[model samples]
Target: MTKYLVFTVLYLAMYAHAGSVVLTDDVVNIRNFEIGYLINSPHTYTIDEAIQAEFTPAPNRLSLPSNQLDIWVRFSVRNASDSVIACNIHNSISYFNRVMDFYETRNGVILDQKHIDLFAWTGDTKLLHGTDSVLPIHLNPGEEKTYYFHFVSPAYQYFEYLILDDQHTLAELSTKNIFPVLLVGMLIALACFNFLLFFSARYKEYLYYSLYLVSSIIWFVFEYGILSHYFGIYGMRGHLTSYGLLSATIFLSLFVKKVLQTAKFYPLQNLALNSTIVLLVLNLLWGVVNFFNALDISVYFFIYAIAVYFWVSISLMRQGNTLVKYLLAAQLFFIFFALFGILFYEGYLPYNWWTRYSIAIGVTVEAFILAYLLSHRIKLLKVDLETDSLTGAFNRRTLFDQFMQESKRISALESLVFVIFDIDQFKLYNDTYGHPKGDDILKIIIHHLQSQFPESSVFRLGGEEFALLFTAENAAAAQRKVSDIRLAIEHLSLAFPESRHGVVTASFGASVIESGRIQNFNELYQQTDARLYQAKHNGRNCVVM
Candidate 1:
């Protein structure tokens, strides 16, 4: 009786252990569950069928207990050759086991995976179930059963919070695209503005700015994939894109060359231009190599920009014009943008669309400034062309243009006064202290005549001679003004140290239109010339009226 009783107790204990539950995450996008109790021995059971369902898994997310936090996760078990494989998981944290709930009343292994509310452990963590053949319903070869499961931890859920991350590269591209358009519009506007300035000013600086603006637009189009995107230049993508930097280098080099005009100072200006041409051709060849090899020519852009800025600045400082000072300002801006691109590519700064496109802003603004400076330079040059360089007075060409218009006024009136003067001993001064010192003496005489005619106008009529047309009370006041001019020239302190005449002096003569006696200005001009010789013959420093 004792033996029988012991056997019964042993059988009960074995039955209880056999009915214990076992679960596992298999090689599928779902979880597998099985009952460890196998009443029929040696029975090969295939997966009867599979069905997809939805349910909330039990939550055990809190550290308090397994049942404290509801646990669930969306999962699927895909067909894997002859078995089921569970996958489609996030590796944000680590690989972990998933828990799955099956609708018990379903015809087959129905898995509910709608509400994920659980934490599954993986790696070296303790498992919730044991490995047993009874726990896993095996399938035949070339057959599969799919199911759903949840992945969650039995205890901490907040510590395993899901982190949102973007996965679509197109989204990033579109976002980047928005910024480049704004930059492109700004650059185009800048170029157009400079074009307007060029038309308004007609200065060479604007010409250079226009060239740079064109190069920049081309560069930006190349940089943004626009060549491929809009222009369908993908077949020539390698050639087009690689040569963009090279073209920018060349156009900008030309701009700098024009901006600084260093050749004006350099004894070998043409030689420098030739060498620069060679460098440009070399850049083009390297660009071809880069296109064939997929090697980025971005570094060349930097090297060329630096080289250009250095050369331009040096040239401008040496012998550049007013436009050069402004170009030098532009160089600083260009260098700043180039360095920014360098730092970004070197990993020293974050690469961003705005950071890349902002170079257009610098170029646009710098071009505008250059355009303004060039326009001003053009105006200054125009003023110079109409004035005498040595005497700082209006030249005879300007005087003649004014004379034709003034003749009408004198012809309308009953009287007018005209005078012509020649420095009597200027030739002696020129023969004495070389031409440069003679030039100073002529300028001194011009200044004296100009100051003496505070209300009248005086003009240099070529070397050592001058003329004036004035309205006076009578011919006597005009003759007095002429005498005053001669006396002023004689009083100047710039004496020729070796003049045979011993001192500088000038003779003047005046003519008056009395009762329309001067029918034509040509006759009046000849009469004044005859009187001028009489003053010189009467001795220097005197006026003949």
Candidate 2:
């Protein structure tokens, strides 16, 4: 029995030194290094027992599969320098909410101890500046110390550790964080720009896009530890991270539905998009009630939502939707890069900047492209609303707007002439030949009128009624131009079988106003209508000026 006991003690001693890291330089990267894990709760094993626990090498990065277990990691550092050295043990992941107990021991006796709880908002105040937990160590030349870390979290956690000279650690951390800081700044600027656009255009899609930017910015700032330095809020990082991700998903879905007009072309995809939003909302509610495990299941839902969005975008692109091409280009890079980033964080991929800040870069490109698309869409909608579909002339709304603008620019020496004309005996002609033929005759008349008075602005006031505004050199010139248009219509001699003259005819009325006169469009319209009445009474096919 005494021999067996000695053998067990020897085995424990050998296992404890198996994962030692020999420190021979100024810095040591402990990532993916040999380490041992105790997959039991903290209370289940003492520091000595944990040191004797079976050891396994972690992946390039370490990740816990489930949140319900506590993991104990053990590694040793041997100081090979000729003089005493001071170093800092740093864990760069700031988004995890966990409690860590660090122990340093020599010859089976603990020499120093420290505790860091990311969710407690206390402990290791000096470490706050670096936005992570840090342990300072002093080791004499040729001395070796074994370290143990007890980590407890309720969600998957990541670990990336580095040991560096204490003096240069803070400076190096600042330099490493510069790019993420710039990324968050750019995202905030984009959010503000889109927010202002939403107000100016009153477009719901712009509002959704702005909200998406805000959510993404919040997630990036918090995930990258930028907010951890200034805020004392603890235990809320995981919840806030989940909130930002879920809200971003909802906003992105809404924005795509509106921008792509999915309801019209891809109704099934639109329905699926909405369903994902509802599921996200439910997940958010679940998170609110149970904060610890809120994101454990919701992350999969987020993946599904992103998949639905990509499918809809691709389907639209396949249908020859030009605007969707921009969406596809912007979202494709973002989705793939973001997926890689998440995998990297979960320890499925090696650490790199592309995997770290992929979402930020993707979002920046998306914001610029989407803003351009919104502006272009607004311009096209304006054109559609202001144009007359039938006659290709400016509609009444556009005519009024142009007239108001022209009135503002008129000089004292300029003269404005307004002309109103319509088909004579138009009701009788329509009653005899039907409305389709009447429409064709109207189209022919408009074609001729537009050709004759190419220099003037024309408008179709209503059925069988048209108007033109001419700013010629003088009133005489305007009158001569009007007479030419009247003579051209008579020469056309368009056949109208039911007319008394067996031909189409029209009457014209004109009202000329000198530049000095301050006359509104309503006044000019009345004067022109009176002249039109006189021309109709004097027998159709004549011009009254």
Q: Compare the candidates by lDDT and give the number of the best one.
A: 2
Provide the TM-score for each candidate, comma-separated.
Answer: 0.54, 0.77
Worst 10 residues of 2 by lDDT: 59-68
Score each candidate by Cα lDDT. 0.51, 0.74
* Pairs that clash in candidate 2: none
Q: Model 2, stretches more than 4 Å misplaced? A: 1-46, 58-75, 121-126, 260-270, 292-294, 314-322, 388-393, 404-458, 467-496, 499-519, 528-545
Cα displacement (angstroms), candidate 1, residue 198, comes to: 8.5
Give candidate 1 misplaced runs (Cα > 4 Å). Answer: 1-209, 224-244, 268-274, 288-298, 301-308, 311-323, 345-347, 351-354, 402-419, 447-458, 468-481, 496-502, 509-534, 537-540
The TM-score that candidate 1 achieves is 0.54
What lDDT is obtained when candidate 2 is compared to the true structure?
A: 0.74
Model 2 clash tally? 0
Give one digit per residue, the lDDT tens place, for model 2 in 402-511. Answer: 87777667777777778899888899888988899889888887888788778788888888888888776678888888888877776789888666567898899998
